[model samples]
Target: MLLKKNEIVEIEITGMTAEGSGVGRVEGIAVFVPGAAAGDRLKVRILKTAKTYAFGKIEEILEPSPERIESDCPCSEQCGGCAFRHITYAEELRAKENRVRDAIERIGGLQNPDIHPIVGAEHADGYRNKAQIPIGQDKQGNLIAGFYANHSHRIVQCDCCALQPKPFEQALDAFLEWARKSGESAYDETTHKGKLRHLYLRMAEGTGEVMVCMVVNGNGLKGEDSLAALLRERVDGLKSVLINSNREDTNVVLGRRFRTVWGQDFLTDRMCGLQFRISPLSFYQVNHAQAQRLYALAGEYAGLTGKETVLDLYCGTGTIGLSMAGRAGRVIGVEAVAQAVENARENAALNNIENAEFLCMDAAEAAQLLVQRGEHPDVVVLDPPRKGCAPELIRTVADMAPSRIVYVSCDPATLARDLKLFRELGYAAGLITPVDLFPRTKHVETVVCLSRKNPDDRIEIDLDLDELDITSAESKATYEEIKDYILKNYNLKVSSLYISQVKRKLGLEVGTNYNLPKSENTQVPQCPPEKETAITEALKHFSMVPFK
Candidate 1:
């Protein structure tokens, strides 16, 4: 019973996938239908089919799910944003929590994990402090500004979006009206000849100060003053108007060059009782109110007692670290982006946070550098990108021996992968809380607390030298010996877990089972080839294995 493209089939949606698509089955093969929800009965047309799964489009909803609701925004169906807008907020929260739990248990190989309920947003709509709408022309050659349609670059002409505040809509409308009058054409990705590319807007949630930035293909826009005046008159709380020149033929929205046209080049936003200067390139969270909640949860997980030295990895603009600076003895923030580090340092100074310091380096390299300097943190906070922490970074953090590691992640699958690595390195995953930062969207923010397992509690085996066969020290390398060999020969400081993983892959029994119990243990991935070579070389140098 293989499904064919354009084949209409009846399905009873049973659940939801991580991508916010509804799960249904036809003859035991899973079919994912977008715009569908759990508990819905639908007639779907198979768009694509694979050996094990299929993708479909909802043709008709024979029976709607109880959690399903009518979306208020007309563009929600066409726009790529807000995948879960058709479902109730309660259902969204439940789905997010379940997603986190499933990732931890099913993917991370944790049993009965302590996963808390999702913290729902206070206001689902109008919570976003930033909006970047693409400007283009409709089929009639009329100026338009809106979001891209789902999986396509085609602009869905929208004057407003439900996720953004009303002021953004007004600002967008003003820009559209002005562009139409000025006869400026939208930038085409194919031709790359138009002037206007995008309208980037940011609003200070607390102060109601708005910053409008027009991303143009050139240095300046024609009649910029008139456009600024129209925005100031039409949009309340308008504070700054600027232009970002992105001359390069790329898909990136903001360029490196910026010129203020009307007001300041940056706007100030207050968060966690501290004021922050936000430029167009700053990585501030879109949902400010929910960010406060997320940071508060991270702080709570940090459990600062005014005497702990906290290391904030991936500390964007020093927000998370500065949020806890008042209570921490010292806060060291590390970020890879140079501009973000500059902003973080300035933010620390702006907040008068003398106890906090910012450093520009990759998270793993910074942690290793700190360790080299004999600097140990009581708490290490990780807010890595969506790909999650690198295994080497996780190993470094574990080697730093922080009492607690607070992981803030945007992607559950990656978080689960990192958590598994942490567990292998003697960290026990603890309370994990999911927060609905981006409402009406499939994305969810999660904070996980990992505490180092007590070394004394680990099972230790005593061996008698007389009962064992006589062997030289090089016959079987100790973990330290293997590590030293790798570092000395290859200049690669490999983790003991990596060596153990290589050993297991070579059909060698590990000395001790640091992994989960056999029943709970899933197949952990082997060390990457580069590191595996180092591990194999170490094993050979220690005479643990004969030459291949």
Candidate 2:
């Protein structure tokens, strides 16, 4: 039967996409409906239809799914952030676990994968550590700062969101009232004319330290100083107030240049007793409470001993490395971002940790060099970006043959791909744990433990607690000793030039087509002379020689 726009059709959703869209077969053809989840048999109105599939919206839910529940936030349906808000927490976990399992089996081509129960958060709601609200004016010209609407750049004035802590919501409300009185025009993406572009607020949930950055479209921040001063007085936890001017239309980044007007440039957050200082640009996990659970699982997967040397690749701000520092002999982390490396170093110092050290370098290059130097880590913990481990990095790691490997990933397809590479390198999968850090979203974080195969060793773990001594500090000491031994044998400090060279040769290139800076068409270069030089200097670590 042909479906018409806004015509309610009851269909059973069979599958779900990574973007949280539901899939249903309509006359042997697939139809996609947003705000729908698997196990949902509902009446959805067809919004638009293509030759292959149809787009829809839920007009009336004739029969609610067993997993379905009322969304906590009023704006949950409209906002793009939370996708699984309507589902119960238990069901959400199951869905996330299934997603991971499916990705491994279907995308990774693994048979009967051993996926463990998902690690859950202590608190399901109000666990967010960071929130970025785009500043824009309402229909009545009232200044507002909130998230964009679903599938649109238009700002949605969300005064109440369940994910953000009470302090964050209060601060935003205060800003909204102040901005309305102050007559600051919200940045209009459509017109490219407005004073305020984004209000970036990040809080260290454990410490109650808050960092706020007001992203504007222009260089000069007129009437921002007074606001900053007021914020310092009103906001108890306000540590940093910055202005980031991003004039570009594209949403690649907020801005590069930042001026700190109040307090410090960054804020500190603690996870598993490890302190991590985060800046405006630094990427940290959003859910603080849930992230702790995820990291704990990763540490368990690593099976760290005090005598073991551990290598943490793609160690953003060294959260995992620093957290596991006490349990390991030495924790050496490699990150591509220099700023993140600096932050990681600062975090280590702040925590008074001497055993952990971080370096700014490409993972592939560092691995190859470590292998060449005959100083390989006993255990390797990798938490890579959504892209997962590069093939070169995988090959290098395989050759090194770490005794134990803990792989944490946000994208399952990539995880499976990398797992396949590891399996080929004579590693056997030990355990796979999926953690739902981001609820109401299709995304899931998974930690997989893989050990170098020993033909004679098939040791069985005793599940009984009384059999093992949990009170003893022997495990911690053993992990630390191994780490120290590895670091002493292998020099940690190496030049970034090699890593930079390899990345530039193989990694994807960004240009004008991707809304990047184009200089040839202009009289002067697109970037300011000083800024260009600094960027060039930074890229040197990645082997990207600056364009002369």
Best by TM-score: 1
Cα lDDT computed for each candidate against the true fold: 0.85, 0.74
Per-model C-alpha RMSD: 7.9, 15.4
lDDT by residue (144-212, candidate 1, tens digit) is 888998788899988878889989989998888888889788998998899999999999897888999
Q: Tens-digit lDDT track for model 2 on 1-548?
A: 56667767779998777777778977766778887767888888888977777888877776777777877787777777887787778877776788889888887777998888988766777877788887777788777666788888787778877888877776777677667777667777678787777777889887899887878788856667777877777776888888787888878547778888878898887778777889777768888878888888888887877878899999888888888888899999998888889998998999999998787888888887666565568889989899999988887786565788999899988998888878776677779998878766667899999997654332211122222332232222222333243345433322222222222343423221222223323211122233233333434433334344
Assess candidate 1 and give its lDDT: 0.85
Question: Where is model 2 more than 4 Å wrong at Cα?
Answer: 1-8, 37-39, 50-52, 454-548
| lDDT for position 189 in model 2 | 68
Most accurate candidate by lDDT: 1
* Candidate 2's TM-score: 0.79
TM-score of each: 0.83, 0.79
